[model samples]
Target: MQKLATFIRGDLVYDGSLVSDATLQERFQSSIDPEVVASPPLLGPKGIPQFRKLDFTRDPRLAGVQNPTLVLWGTEDKVNRPSGARSLQRRMPNCDVHLFSKTGHWVQWERADEFNAMVVAFLAEDSADALDFRRV
Candidate 1:
């Protein structure tokens, strides 16, 4: 986990999950769109391998890239703690880490406004300065 966290590719923070958040655990258990469990149609049509590929358990390093990175972690995230964010930050060549005290792994969803603002601000600043990642 630590290796993947440090070696990955794009904008990401190393928000660590010390443990599972009670709420996130509950929600994940009762998630509306759970993907791990196979549904008959998808399984039958695509096969087990394809269905498993839908999982988002990619290498963490993929998220630890050298792009203009912003690491946002909910201090309260049981599953993904501040350490996770830090770990990713260490991997990123350039990074900004933001910790929201009362939030969790679902920080983007829980703190939509702040997240949006930060993203917008980051983008605006990048555009104004013409920081283009596409060229390199």
Candidate 2:
């Protein structure tokens, strides 16, 4: 935990300068609990090994998705690039992308209020659209 925390604090914008060390530490600590550690992580060694091998980026099925989608991303997210969001929007015809400035991979945690509001609005809009389609 120490090494991973040190590395992230030094390399990322989500470092102590943008986000506090205490907050990062708390989140990091929570994930390292005995129960979580013992469990086979989805993306890790113990879980489904095939998950790591498959590249969703090139998956043709993405274009087949017809549902209205809201894709949220952080402008500063190092793990998932913002361009990925744009690609999703392009591939998924009914997709909308929203980028959060000065946020990292943890956009939900970093921009909780704005994230929640946007999600609620998206859901409401989708629901209204469904109702309209039904009426037609």
> Using Cα atoms with residue i matched to residue i, what is each candidate's TM-score against the true structure?
0.51, 0.75
lDDT of 1 by residue, 12-43 (tens): 22243423355445444553444545542233
lDDT of 2 by residue, 1-136 (tens): 6666655654344543665668778868878889988983655344565644554554678899999999988898777677888878878868889999887777787788999999999999999999999999
The most accurate candidate by TM-score is 2
TM-score of 1: 0.51
CA lDDT, candidate 1, residue 80 = 44
| After superposition, candidate 1 runs with Cα above 4 Å error | 1-64, 131-136
Q: What is the lDDT of candidate 2?
A: 0.77
Backbone-clash count (model 2):
0
- Evaluated against the true structure, the overall lDDT of model 1 is 0.60
Q: Where is model 2 more than 4 Å wrong at Cα?
A: 7-15, 44-54
